[model samples]
Target: MAALTCRQVGNDFFKEGRWREAIDKYTDAINLDPNDHLSYTNRATTYSKMKNYTAAIRDCKKSIEIEPKHIKAYYRLANSLKMLHCYDESLVTFNTFLGFEPNNNLAQNERTQVKTAIFKEKLQGAQVHPALRILSWANCDNDPLSCKARLLAATLEFNKGNEDGKNRNVKGLIEITEGIMLDERCFIIPSSINLAVNTAFEQNKALSPTLSVRATILKYKQRLAQDGWDSVLPALATNIRAAFLIGYMSRFTPDVRNIDQGIENIRRAIELASFATEIAPVATDDINSIDPILKITFLRTLKVHLMEAILIKYKRNIEMIDLFDKVLQLAKEVIESCNENPISTEDTISYCAYYRGHLEEAYGAIGSAYNERSKFSRGELGFQERDLKLLLESVKNYEKANEYFPSDDPKFALFHYLTASYKLMIGGCTLHEIKQHAQKAKECEKEAYPVFGNYLGDIFEKSMVFQALEQLKRPNNIASDDKYFLPQACHVSSNSEEEEQRFIREYEARTGGTIAATMDLSQAAARANAEFLRNGISIISSDKQ
Candidate 1:
């Protein structure tokens, strides 16, 4: 009775926007009736309105304790958890509320928003396709944060996939950024970031838009000059520069001059970030909901870029060992910092693992290339033995990389393809063993084609197609000679076949809605035959003419 009176007064105070008065009334009610769940929930709502998420969460938990199935308390708790960046916990609470009130549109919408938030967080750490699909889902409320997140996500995806198809739409990111820039709260964020992303795609260098390649760096610099640098801006600049290096260096041939310029910019960005940290005690505190650990993440990513750039310059050089060791030590230190205060997402962990894996792969590849060159340049002995050892090492490192990424990630396709290539080059392996690995690599590459839209997978698949064709036309090489023998004793053929079929089935099931038909052996065989016949007919027609 007294509790009811206090709640009524609290509601009046809340309606009048007197948050503290409402909190006082609710507190009085809770003291009078310690088990009054309504009082606790009302107080929680007041706390939430004040943006005191921690206090709100406590009150909501108390309300839920009094009544386990309290729907409002569950909702409030979920919102508070979300505000605190406890996404997984908030998701569970949202699910609980939805389970009880199945038809609540508001709850359903909130659940979708929470799911979007989770996807956004996951995307930041790693490239997850399902997360991208959810980010692109229709019916999402016009949430500013979600909009910004989706823009960034789409930008990444477009950068990865745009090369595969010219019709791919990435303009949405720029358009959304343009809209968001109109809001005073959002005006501080650099709009050129997305615009540059869009322009980079236009220049067919989306993978790595160097400052010189695309005017993105110029725009970013201009924006910084106009807006002035904040504690977060330096870190963001470092990230932008690192991204450029990764994309640019991944090319078949990178320009050393451009790399040097990008490296200088990254170093300057790092110095700026250090200065920001020195000036601000709360340098790593969350700014506008962006993670404070970005400075370290950017620094770590920059180190990786530097390693890659240096590797490119010295990959085939005998003196590369000293530089590689220094970079590896620095990367280890950056990774140690992450462990102590972990700012980056699982994606960053995977990114670090990928870089380490690449380092190992680079060492093995460079060593093999150097040994091969030594035969001509330095007259080194046992080049063949060193080749096999180096190839094996490369395969093992790539496999380790695969383990770090998700099972179906397109990135693993490169690892598998490289492994297969090395296995074939290793020699002494049976025809069946070599063929099985080659086929596995081809299939993995083929499956990844849609995501990255790159020709590397096509290159791998073509290698298998050529092998398969050679087996039919000329029974000379391992692939051709091995066609007659299905060495069951080896188990590689049977195991790889089963794995391949399982991968195809899983891919089909997951992409049933999006993909009309998946490529298979039958299609590949038919295509190969058609090409052979066309070539034979061309020869016959030329002779007749």
Candidate 2:
């Protein structure tokens, strides 16, 4: 009776949010009745409220030991484990709790979250092919017809389609397109809505498969706008995934209409993702106020795809300064959030590493965007200062990206080569600076050559040679007495053979015999120069990276 009285006092203190006092009272109760399970469980709850998860876990385990069938003890134990990012243990504990209370919605949601975390962990270092295989396994659920299942299936098909598009496999494209079409059928509302959202869609009644899919998407969007997101929360995952995949897959072909469609779909996905976060109730006081992991995963994926769209638009020479600004803003927001709290727990450590990698990619994209804008600015008069500033900004961002990126990563060489290229393009660069950048570019090409030998390495080497040649050919920049300075440009002429020999000789003399032994710079320089003239600048292709 005395122990019960102490526990009741402790409960009162807990209700008043006097965590330390409540812990003292609970300790009194435990002292009076050493094996009392209720006192232990109550103390565990208090400890958890105090953010003392280790203590909470200990008490929870004790409570369970005293009463094997204690359901609350199991739940508390699982939550404490999850808070510490002991996911495997947390998963086991949740399964035990579910065995006792199988229909608990909160438990089910949490279990699904854990599964998603495990899935993401599995994907950490996987390459594209292995990632596809893992995604394939994820799509093999028993209830494959479920909304979430369909989303996973659609994601797999979209990735396969993307890979196929890269390889220019027409039959594979047709098959994946058909597969995506089948997946779209799952999202069609059973309502009596017509194919037309406006007169434009109505006029084209004999719609192609793509148009039909777009119409279905429009109907779903209309339903979402009419009825609040809550009304379709159950299908939100499928809807968002479908919208994003459809947009991203459109990039496979070079069709302007398809690219436009892709951009619209990606924009919609970003909007929906933002809305989802707004509507979600605040679950914590931490940086991740929503369902942090899941909600962040959605936002991250959508934003990255939006960046991809920006790159696609840039590649096609469409005006996308606005898009570039939007991505820079978005990336800045993510980087700021990721910078906020200090790492404390295992969960925080993992989140930091995961987000750091994305941040590296984000910086890389920003660097490339700035570089492209610099090139674009060169075409207009009186923007030389702006162009130089943009180039400097590009250099700054690329250096930041290198700082965040792992030195041993295969992509590091690519970024290094990029940095080297832009560094040389900086207006009024000193001769010493030129040599430094040129040497760095050569080193990066050497490192990447073995790995990307067939096509990518050749491209980098040729581009570097062309940039170096252009710099050397600038008559007023360097003294004529300097060995690296050339009196005239190495222009290709009708006498191809003689010009080629002269170009190779000039390149060797300028570099002081440091040129690659296997390099045939004549054809390489011509091709690079032609591509440079056509594209204005060689923007980094996000998809290839």
Per-residue lDDT over 73-189 for candidate 1, one digit per residue giving the tens place of the 0 to 100 score: 999998877765566788888899989998989878988888998777666643433223232222222232222233333333333233322333344333322222121112122
- Model 1, residue 368: what's the lDDT? 35
- Model 2 agreement with the true structure over 408-431: per-residue lDDT tens digits: 333455666665555544433332
Clashing pairs in 2: none
The lDDT per prediction is 0.50, 0.56
What TM-score would every model get versus the actual structure? Answer: 0.41, 0.43
Q: Cα deviation in Å at residue 483, candidate 1?
A: 11
Candidate 2 ranges with C-alpha deviation above 4 Å:
1-232, 281-294, 318-320, 341-353, 376-386, 427-455, 460-462, 465-479, 483-545
Give model 2 RMSD, 1 decimal. 16.4
- lDDT for model 2, on a 0 to 1 scale? 0.56
